[model samples]
Target: MIRGIRGAVTVTENHAEDMIQETKRLIETMAEKNQIAPEDIASVFISITNDLNATFPAKALRLIDGWKYVPVMCMPEIDVPGGLEKCIRVMMTVNTSLGQKDVNHIYLNDAIQLRPDLMKEE
Candidate 1:
């Protein structure tokens, strides 16, 4: 069966390095938390807030081992009033035995505010 994992992270700046680093961190966290393997991933969709255009978030995945074969697409997130700034979000579809309810969603930094209900108290 296929399951989806969602994650988001905030970038401190619009620079390419910052975007790359933050996205790398987010993806790495998701992969680690869910035990996602490259062969299990179907595709990844990445969206960035309008304020962040310095680089595509998907580029960071290419730097990771075994992610080169995963299909990735990137787009601009819809700009809404009062939306969080400098945020990048990802939705990865993967073939997993885990049920949807078992999937772990990750949100880091200021982006955590975007999904309080999914976050567990730590």
Candidate 2:
């Protein structure tokens, strides 16, 4: 069966380079924790908050994940009435035999603010 994993992270500042680095770091950490295989990756979708207009987060993943075969798409996040800023969210599906219980979801940096409960123990 296929499993879905999600992770979110934010740039330290508003810098494009920082966003790229943080996004790559969070994905790598999640992938390692979940033991993702390149061949098992179905695809990845990423969204950047309306405030961010720099490099796409998916570019960093393509450059760092070493999974040139997997599909990745990036887009600007919608500006909801009340929403987070300078945030990048990722959703990925992997072709895995493991169940959802075995998946690891990550929330890093300021993005953790979006999930205070998850960060309380960190």
Each model's C-alpha lDDT? 0.91, 0.80
- Residue pairs whose backbone atoms clash in candidate 1: none
TM-score of each: 0.96, 0.87
Residues 1-122 of candidate 1: C-alpha lDDT, one tens digit per residue: 98999999998888999999999999988988889999999999999999998988889999999889999999999999999999999999988888887788999999999988888655
Top of the candidates by TM-score: 1
Lowest lDDT 10-mer window, candidate 2? 113-122
Q: Give residue 9's error in model 2 in angstroms.
A: 0.2
User: In candidate 2, which residue ranges exceed 4 Å CA deviation?
Assistant: 116-122
Best by lDDT: 1
